[model samples]
Target: MRCEIPILLRCCFCFPLRYGLLVWAYLKQISSISFSTVMIIKLCHDYYRIQASGAVISSLIILLMILDIAFNVLFIISAHKKDYKKMRIFYRYSIAVLCLNVAIVGFCIAMYAYYVYVAPIMIIFIWSFMVPTLVMIIVMVFLQGYLIILVRSEFIKLKNNSQFEFVNHGADEKCTANLDFVKEIPGTV
Candidate 1:
């Protein structure tokens, strides 16, 4: 009965349920305009004005989103089977990827802000273009490394806990057997 609760919770958190919510939210955000159309236009405009290669970045962002959606769906299904270990790994990976997406979005927003405030004619060719691009690249690389470390640490902890549980259970069984043997050896005390 005690173990059943965790299993129930795990089932509830499965991929389809979680991914369905994500798909709904994404649809809501893009209900007014097509996602692809906006993405293409934004990429082209950024490429022309800032001389930043926006197409590749934009495509990468889209691809990440698709992967996230698919993983969430898979997670929901996996959880239903009480696969907590896999669920944990899936969530950790999702979080790492989500952090990367956030960094990319932040970089884009920062660039947009710079362009809007700084006079384009004065800074566009040099500072506006090169500075943001360099900064974004550096920050993205650093953040990606950081997220990878975080995920690895989490995996290690999970593995350690499982090992500890296995050892503890074995010890308990051995102790119980010893106690039963002592009981059977009556009058030895």
Candidate 2:
């Protein structure tokens, strides 16, 4: 049971699940916006602007998240192919994505926190959803850090082993073709 815990945690923190949850969270927020909510936005000048801005901002953020998810999927493919350079690039990009997300979510949370005091009703839709999503993202970022370390170590190990094997077996002349290119050239011969 103790040994199974890490595997369980890994599954929970996997890219598919994380990406799905993020999509679900965003969709939930979008779906909750009803006709009444639109009417309220039109009734109040301040809310109309805020709602429009938030809508645009969230849409951009969601697009970024989708791109991040696509990059992660590519990263997984590169890892499987043992392409170390691609893995490095993709992994670095993943970290950048995570940082950008942290910044975006943190800023939104701070805004929500301020609004919580200033306008409780204004924050109602976001507080419960965004808070938990932020926590999950934070956890995923940490998990990704650990995964990056593991990938780096594995890549290094694989590289060294390949080098060692090459040094041991790659030097045997008998194991390779004995024909010299110079001798094989008809005119030169």
Estimate, for each residue in 1-54, the C-alpha lDDT of model 2 and write its tens digit.
354212122223454433333343344335344433554454454544567677
lDDT of each: 0.53, 0.57
Candidate 1 residue spans exceeding 4 A from truth: 1-62, 120-189
Candidate 1 lDDT over residue span 1-189, tens digit each: 354211111112453433433343355335323564576677766765644455667877666555655665555444345444765766577566657667766776676677768766745566666666767766756654443443344344445555654245665654334333454555755
- For residue 117, give model 1's deviation from the true position in Å: 3.9
Model 1: ten consecutive residues of lowest lDDT: 4-13
Candidate no. 1 TM-score:
0.35
Worst 10-residue stretch by lDDT in candidate 2? Answer: 3-12
Question: Candidate 2 at residue 182, lDDT?
Answer: 70
Please report the TM-score between candidate 2 and the true structure.
0.47
Cα error, candidate 2, residue 54 (Å):
6.9
